[model samples]
Target: MSGTFVGMPAFPEAARGAVHNATLRANLRHATTTIRRKRAVAVAELSDWAELREAGKQIKDHTLRHLDRYLEQLEDAVTAAGGTVHWAADADEANRIVTGLVKATGETEVVKVKSMATQEIGLNEALEAAGIRAYETDLAELIVQLGDDRPSHILVPAIHRNRGEIRDIFRAEMTRWGRPAPDDLTDTPAELAEAARLHLREKFLRTKVGISGANFMVAETGTLVVVESEGNGRMCLTLPETLISVVGIEKTVPTWRDLEVFLQTLPRSSTAERMNPYTSMWTGTTDGDGPRAFHLVLLDNGRTDTLADAVGRQALRCIRCSACLNVCPVYERAGGHAYGSVYPGPIGAILSPQLRGTDSDIDASLPYASTLCGACYEVCPVAIDIPEVLVHLRERVAQGGQVTRAGTKVVLKPARGHAAERAAMRATRWALTHPGAVRAGQRLAARTRRFHPSRLPGPGKAWTATRDLPAVPPESFGDWWKRTNGGTRDERGGSR
Candidate 1:
């Protein structure tokens, strides 16, 4: 709501408080369980859902590989059809282009459809700095706007808040933005929505400019698509006389057919519906149809760099469905703000460090936020293997070297936390490779099993501080198996 994401703490520090908040945990449990169940039902309806998911993954991969070509074609098609196209390399450039466009229209305010790209680039704050107000029309975004908070989930930005908190936000903050909530505002869903609708209605009508971000952009037709449960997206896309969209390059697909695949998958995966309640599709400006003038600012903002890594590139396939977030153990407990970026949860863990680089403690800590749980991969509609990317990024962090940022290369100064982990891992590797020493150590441990302390007393103390060490096995599994089977088991079943 403050339109800023500056000076946020790293993921570990931020997640500390979230893990202890019982109320936040309750809200997360209810929302994630409900969404996950509905998603399972919606997905079951499509018998070839796995195939569709694979298709989506391959299509995104192919598009990203040829991103430059498709982007050029998209720009050509949009410009030929009466829309102006601008290329922005980073958030600052994107914000500059959008603010300049709004200023050229001579409007002091603009209505907005929920767009993560816009949020990632901090467009609202940029507009406000330049004397233009951007009003969030989506119900969830409106709640975030009024509450002066950051969105924790991609699809459901205000998933962390419940009905009661929303009513309070409306009652307390609506007047400052536009229309005021009734004095007797209650926590009922209808009352909350009505308050928001009345509050945003006037802003939509009065604003001459509409700022939006697209879910997918079609290269073959230069068409952009935005899907939302609320009709506010349609209102903002249509009611304004002038429109501007800042879209990330990753949103593009090859053709209408490709768009169709995601349209089905995205809505069901994200909102648990057969189709979105309101789907807005527009090409370059249409005469007397939608906005009379149109401008699209194509944003890279570190996306190209992310596209370069083969293993990590799958993250670019994400359609912002947030299904991964609904099933993520870390996200459910830590909430969204801990991610320290607009993108949060599993997708954020992998995507943020790539986009922002691991130079900062927050970005570096993000990749390690999870318990290496694979739930995120199971729920991802686009088939993004989140756990794989998390491990890959972890390696990048541990290897200790330089990394490219934007276009400039910078040395990745190793963090003290990472250095310690690397040293411990090296020590483990050494011990495991020396079987003679390992066997002796196991025998020693078995001999002292009864006297083994409940907690570790060295550097391992930090790890054992909050946990009880598992009782050492009476004998190592290998020793027990060998003795029982007379060393003739063959290990064909494979060692654990």
Candidate 2:
């Protein structure tokens, strides 16, 4: 996990603050609602959406099943295409590799396309710590960088900020990083975009290095694909003398044909476009076109651990389209920062715990951040079944188990505060197994119903604080069943 999110509070604690921010909630609701509606329409245009989704699922599953072989093939293909491939087992190693590469270029600054991989590894912060500057060129990313804020969405990093907030960030922060925004910048979309464009153009022309993360990597031809609405990715991909892409190993597909399914699904799922405005594909470096030196850093960062879980591994099938986020009720209210990871929303709820493990407060609480309404699964292009994974992870967190961390298997203690829950589940199992005991307990509860408190005490206080405890029936259901011959029972314990 990136050091940037170290010491983040648990989800409930973080969400409490975000949930109160009326402006942030409004921004998120408006943006996500619009995206969701547009996405639904775009998806309806596809006649074979189900087939495309299934194909994508199968492709990812097959590639993951034989990841070792496919990754080697991908490495060979990349090397054959006059590019170098570096394997990073974790975030620190990945950052070190990238920093070394940038330092080797003898350049202090690099322009970046919006790359979740880079953000996940805290590459910008790493580069800055090493005395090198990394400029984000994507409009949303530029806004995020200028505001000194974390990305709140996968596609739109600045989705939490409205136009006015963006204008303020641009006017106040742009000069600190690079070229200043116009003296009188307004909140209009066109003006904000132009200000970002003019600010980035100088970096595009002068910077010798560029960094990015790929949407997909083709093993058969060593092709990397980046789908974006902004031309910033194309500019970053082409204008630099040295191009370095840090990508997750899970992003690789077996062939270009497999890439086709995602190309269709990703844009529609993400931007609600038939296709993104700019879809950039390149095979290493060309003689006189694009960067002369190209490098691909394949980052594992606990993806291998994620792949080892049966039910949870399906999370790797995510294409980062963020359809799940747009439709997520939790994300709409609590916003992205609550997840406490580079990945946010429903996908983050499942993906972050697996990637980072459940040892930390934030990671342990992530599984419970959702309503489990299955909206995320419904919208997922690859049918990731996010709710299922979330529940599975919850189980993992509730019960101590062996988990892989940094390629080493270690036993984890059950998360704190689950002792009461575990005891209750045990009591439930015992009662269910003994019919006589359940009947006796039911009768006792019924007889003692009048003494019951509306609010519980001790560990159960939190549960009852916001909810009314159900009143126990005057008689047991079993007693009523015996009296009524299973026909019906009235509220007064009379047979009907």
Candidate 3:
């Protein structure tokens, strides 16, 4: 529930506990089912939905290909607009930069807009360690913060909690963070919203430093955009005296024209809305308008390494829409916590391993998390081939380790476990490639079919425990075909 993902087990192990919890399963089933149904209706409204989806994908791909040029352009534009840009190579560097910025402001508390980039770097935990209090203003995020829980979904962090649970959390935990919930508060939507609003209002007015993550950063205008259904993002962006936005480098697009494609796709894909209720945009700072000081920390955080992979680089195209999560059978039952990262579901399966590497149990296990149903790929706004990437990462996991390309040099890091799986795959590859060996092996197996065991031995025993091992035929297909002369005759070469 804490910001840190340390010590979490692999997906299968973590999911085991979640799958058994009846309350958790009920919560996930209801939430994901509702969201996916509504998203379908919203998407159906657009006649050119397919075109828009393709446009968004093309825009993201183009930007990623020329990310350096656009990023440099963005820096020049932001600096020209009275904003300072800082580049962070990883999470530690990003946290240090953000912490230093807050410390320099001489403030101990900061209000936060729901920013995945900040969460990814564990900025809240990092700031807490530095004695700085970071408050989450988004209602769902507020629920997560007050409940001391990690986000299960990208858009709706509190999706795992029902209304009754939320009411209880508000009553029990609200006072510790700020204003107490009304003693007679009911388990109604309005009351819960009001309670969160009142509690967060105090922090919004008092806090001078605000931290955020943008949905999109326009390279041409040096503008950062945050789109949300609630008005909390607007409050965090404007009310605070100094605003520090920690954004991923891949969030950049070449121009506002390019931004337009996502503007249409992101809202519908994420919140199922035609347009977000509040679309906040800021070009650095306006002396009389918004924050006095604006700092942009562009975070790499293994993104550059992920970019080194041709298939894996598509993850950077993510706009943080939870569309894939809603449609994913694996995520619905297992929940986001099973993935053990800020990003969860289908995207997490491929993205986490690449960003964090497959050395850990969780990362290695993430690739095998899905059924490879391709529901995720179908819903993705950017059309990222999530299933394709999942297969690619699985290959990496089973083939020893990651193959990272740094310019002309390729670096390989040995990963733990998967030895048996690797051996099996290698043997399979060899057997499949050698026609004579395959034919001979099939003939030998067919000859000894009567003596074959009903179950496999060793590690494969568990696989065949619940399911029957297929019965081998008395004769191999080749021999049958040859004997029948391609099935034209029974025992003679002549046609019957």
Candidate 4:
């Protein structure tokens, strides 16, 4: 949830821990593969899924293009409909706004619907600083909270933890928060669920305020939508007197018709169902029906900065279904925690660097996490071309070691102790740009192919020490091709 990715290791360093954990790998494989297959089946059922996907993409793009206009419309509508709209420019601003909102409501505790926006802003940590207790109502989120763990997957936050591990977290940590874990708490799905249910039910009914993040907010109707599999969303949306929704600016769609596209694609892509069990929506506030007072905090938090980028702005189109995560080979082996952001896996690889910038070793490392296999692109409901973006970002990172912000580029210096890579890359780029020097060097290497060393020397010697250099042929490929097949002779022969 931290804005800065300082102290987080690069992907290779973080992934090493995940790859070594056999249980994590097994859990990732089983869960992702199952979800991938189910999602494929659900998607195949809809004949117009592609159009829906495109519409969703276009809707997000259009809204983003005229974001200032749509956002003002949203603010006007919400205010007219008896809701207050607060704008947050960054994580710190968002957190301060949320903390102030809670303090204004005179509530020390808030029951929360599963909200990724809050996670990105670290609202809970911020609230804790102000002595306001925030409770997660969604079941997986409850598991994450009670377990004192960070969310791994977006849809299923506790996907990394098996039942056994969950049982341990609940047994170990739940009591200190509010209700005690049942003495008979077991790893059995139903029992674990029951333990969480009892624990959350109390917080729901007792809390005076609720906090949430919406999947989509409709500008025309001043509506906020929350889609989920559990009944927790219903509790958070209805049970409290004052409901405060903290949502990202990018989550806005122009109208209800636009909302419907994601309603179809999101449920199928994320949970592998025809529809989520709960799709709770509200327009401002309804007296006696739900929360009597409502507030919508529209958070920018680096989004506007990201949207200014031509190639990077496409990341804003994500609906966070995380289908790409399931199909990602790197995510399967390395797991989600390695990404070090609330959003993880394929979406995280592109989205995180944009939202957080590639300043840190972790964000810089994320662009290189993929094999660029394009499996993520195949599964993405919005067709986010994640591999394309990853490579674009990798170029952004490796070339100047920096990311651009608002038409300006910022170069990043190598972290302490990684200077050798920067130097190596600089030399490589220099060698590549000068063709005459490269050709002469190549010819000499070919002439002395047998005498050429198998390993690099100097600062690079350590890199090739363990791995053998590729064998160079006696003749360069260009020379061999010229000697063996004259271009004109081959054309005359008409081999094709």
Q: What's the distance in Å from true for residue 223, model 1? A: 0.6
RMSD of each: 3.9, 2.2, 2.2, 3.7
lDDT tens digits by residue: candidate 2, 1-496: 1135779999999999999999999999999989989999999999999999999999999999999999999999999999999999999999999999999989999999999999988999889999999988889888888887888898898899999999999999989877899999999999999998899898899999999999999999999999988799999999999999999999999998887799999999999999999999999889999999999999999999998888999999889999999999999999998889989999999999999999899999999999899999999999999989999989989998888888888898888868999999998998899999999888999989889999999989989999999899998878877877675766566767
Tell me the whole-model lDDT of each prediction, alpha carbons only: 0.88, 0.92, 0.89, 0.85
- Per-residue accuracy of model 3 over 238-279 as CA lDDT, tens digit each: 988999999999999989888778888898999888888999
Count of clashing pairs, candidate 3? 0
Alpha-carbon runs more than 4 Å astray in model 2: 1-3, 484-496
Encode model 1's per-residue lDDT on 199-246: one tens digit a residue: 888888788999899999999899989888878999889999998988
For TM-score, candidate 3 versus 4, the one ahead is 3
TM-score versus the correct structure, for each prediction? 0.92, 0.96, 0.94, 0.91
Number of the candidate with higher lDDT, 3 or 4: 3
Clashing pairs in 2: none
Against the hidden true structure, what lDDT does model 1 obtain? 0.88
lDDT of 4 at 354: 90
Over the stretch 1-496, how does candidate 4's per-residue lDDT look in tens digits? 2133348898889889999999999889999989989999999999999898888778888998998888888888888888989988788988888898889989899988888998988888889889998888777887778767778888888888888988998898888888988998889999988898888888888898989999998888788899987788899889888888999999888887887788889999988999988889888888678988898989988888788678888999898898989989999999988998888998999988898887788988888899999999988888888888898887777655544564467665545544677787787899899977877888998888878787888877987977989987776766656655745445345543
